[model samples]
Target: MSKPSILSKLNSGVESSSPPMAHPLRQRVPSTAIAGLGRSLDDLAADSVATIDPALIDPSPFGDRLEYDEEATNLLLAAIEAEGQRLPLLVRPHPKIEGRYQLAYGHRRLQVLRILNRKAKAFIRNLTDAELILEQGAENGGREGLTWIERALFAKEMEGQGHPSKTIWTTIGVDKSGLSKMRAVVDTIPDHLIRSIGRAPGIGQPRWQELVDALAIDGAIKRAASILQSKEISSLTSDQKFVGLLRALCGQSSLAPHSGRREIRSSEGRSIARLSSTAKGDVLAIAKAESRFSAWLTEKLPEIYRQFLIEGATSTLDSERPATGAADSDGTMVVISQP
Candidate 1:
């Protein structure tokens, strides 16, 4: 499918070639002309279109998007530079701050214009909190559209803003059942972790719910977060980051096929542990040469785990009694992370 611009359907009614300075401002096209009755993007009147200095405009208070794709954004920048900005952004006069405006949509266009050092063309409207969010949702939903998690996060944001469920459902283009599932996932997981995971557009609702269910286990949050904070986590793709955390939380082995052993190295590049994976489980063998370190690790296991339980409680879903980890017959210890 062709990518949609920020204006979406509104671009059809908007006049091309910004008129002269003395020209009359373009009047608000009727809602019916843009979207038919009862559409999410409809009803908000865009009273005028004007060219305003990009410096005077501010970001939207109710943001619906997480982040823009770099490739897509660069494409937009190139298009605007070559053809000039064809679509106008939507903004409202700042309610409290003087001589300032708050954006409703078209953030990408505005940012690109700022880079190009050009003024912005915009649809000016005074919108209520509900209307502002709805417009934000409609513009996004109508345009390139949000990923599953983005829609869920947007639903949570709307609810926090005091918008009714009907508005939330229609705006995000989800049914009641879908909205309930979204709320379930968003409410259970920490927003910080979800945001850390990024849009994960390839991830679907089933995988999200699986993450949620895993988070319900005792010490799961701290366990998952430790993995997330690990150096390897940052280098991983969004989906890989999520799957790793989920596996850690559920105490499940990696879903990937067994690929022999991978080395666990110390900061100085010495091999400290050898990790081998199987469908049934994984084993971390402390190097025989480092007997002192292995003994230290064994002695510290209980103390380290005590700390994990105490800390995990803070981020735990509910009050949970500390659970014990399974050990090999030789009694060597395996741990998620050391405190």
Candidate 2:
């Protein structure tokens, strides 16, 4: 027997002579089943992974992360080299250029692929600017995550680009209060200072607020400039550099003497004490000493002063008293009367 055509089978609403498993009855299929099939095809299209040349993929114009750890990147590169890329990156078709794509996230992975001279496995989607930001923000938040200052700067950048606060909050996975605090840090801290500090990963809102308060003091900017210019600050890691700057600012006020007294140094030129001429008396301020000698000196000060006083009085008596020396029953005696 000849097989029936698919169109004729659909039109006649009849089962085909072919086995049930060989040909599905189109007429018997429900509208819901057809819809489900269409959805499955759409999903497959959306989820299909493709390997594309790294040169064709441009970084997201709205990328949030500013700093990447060298060691972490090296580790990632080693992993990809040994185990291959386990996850695919998300990217959108380049809006302005043909035959190009823009990354929404997975910048590190893309960089590794480029360095390896290999193609990037990515999920291509048509994304709007808002959608791009959302996807980028979500991926970053769910992953290793941006530092506090990084997030602050990102929020500020988004605001500068005219994105609303609600959108930014959603993207950053923060509430209104958290967004406000982040913005406050970005607003209060100077741009040069922030750039000098880099991304302080573990630093939080309170420490940032402390930094802002420190910056409000007079000469803070100059002090911060001096700190950034120092070799020690330059040698520190990003997080350590931030902490060094903060310590410099906070310590500036304490290091300056309130009494306007000059510090006194020991014979070795170490500042061991300070001297201030006050209306009531000459105030002698000793520098903080944590040594055993300091503890011994503190304990023996009273006895030493008492002995000094006794020696001074005896010397005065000897100098002023008349020479009246007589041999007593057992020894010589000198009786000196008070003048």
Candidate 3:
């Protein structure tokens, strides 16, 4: 289901009545914080409401959205101009900075207040880092302001900050497996590259996974870097940039493997294994034509691969003694090595 737009959230006056009217402007922080994933915007828990200087407050260390919508901001500016800042921003006394405050939520409101050169109405509390993030999540929750990659990036931030896996799961509202997939993408893609592509609100993990696979090919990251810096992508939108990068990369790195084949042979000129590639994937077939060796190969592949990874790809398993084991009672034992 599509998430409700910021405009829809703005029109929902089910919580509070109109306030007195205000003006516009913006900056966001880089943060990994999200808590109370189901909380509503107007329902933040606070001690009291008072007006404070927007300029004195800084955005939270964690961020939610990838990019702000200018049209949405204009709509927000018009609304506050008529309603007079009905909802109060959530803030706390800065833990480190003596004279300043840290904003928990209401980033857009704070921006507008800063532009109007007016003080912001806010609920001030002495909040810990965790608590501040939760308050911020409460404000952003149910708004669907975050895109798929944005959530992944936010999840990456949460893990980086030492938040336990369970905490991250609850905060981001994703399962353990979901978090794992997000980590894979963030781990494979460089941070600056993700920021360059922007939010990619229209793109999902599957398409992003394509880029991940393409990048895994040797020299693919360099190819991707070149594509990102090209003049063609420089003028594209965020989603457009992603499409262009993926298209360029697919043509360069991914296509090189298709319609390719590698056939191994023994010193005696006997066939060993035939490796063929297609759009679907690579297929490896052993010429032994014996079920026992195939079974042995299947059972030992993981162990062989694990050793290769642990020791480094430069080292081969050919030097090791051949694998040995008895087969099923009716079948013969087969010895096979990485050679």
**lDDT top scorer:** 1
Residue range with the least summed lDDT across 10 consecutive positions in model 1? 317-326
lDDT of 2 by residue, 1-339 (tens): 444443444569676686557666577544433444344334434467999999999999874766677777898999999999888888899999999999988899998999999899988888888767766765675574688888888778778767888878866667899999998888988888887777777788877887787778778878887888788788777767777677555442222232335565544666655565322224555657725535654676576557646667556554223222223344422122222
How big is the positional error of residue 300 in model 3, measured in Å on the Cα after superposition? 33
Q: Deviation in angstroms for 108 in model 1?
A: 1.4
Candidate 1, residue 117: the lDDT equals 97
Report clashes for each candidate as comma-separated counts.
0, 0, 5
- Where model 1 places Cα greater than 4 Å from the true spot, the runs are 1-46, 252-339
Residue lDDT tens for model 1, 9-100: 66887778965788677986764313533342343332446899999999988766666677677888999999998878888889999889
Q: What are the lDDT scores of the predictions, listed in order?
A: 0.73, 0.70, 0.69
Distance from true location, Cα of 302 in model 1, Å: 29
Instruction: Tell me the TM-score of model 2.
Output: 0.58
- Candidate topping TM-score: 1
Question: Compared to the true structure, candidate 3 yields what TM-score?
Answer: 0.61
Evaluate model 1: give its lDDT: 0.73
**Per-prediction TM-score:** 0.63, 0.58, 0.61
Superior by lDDT: candidate 2 or candidate 3: 2
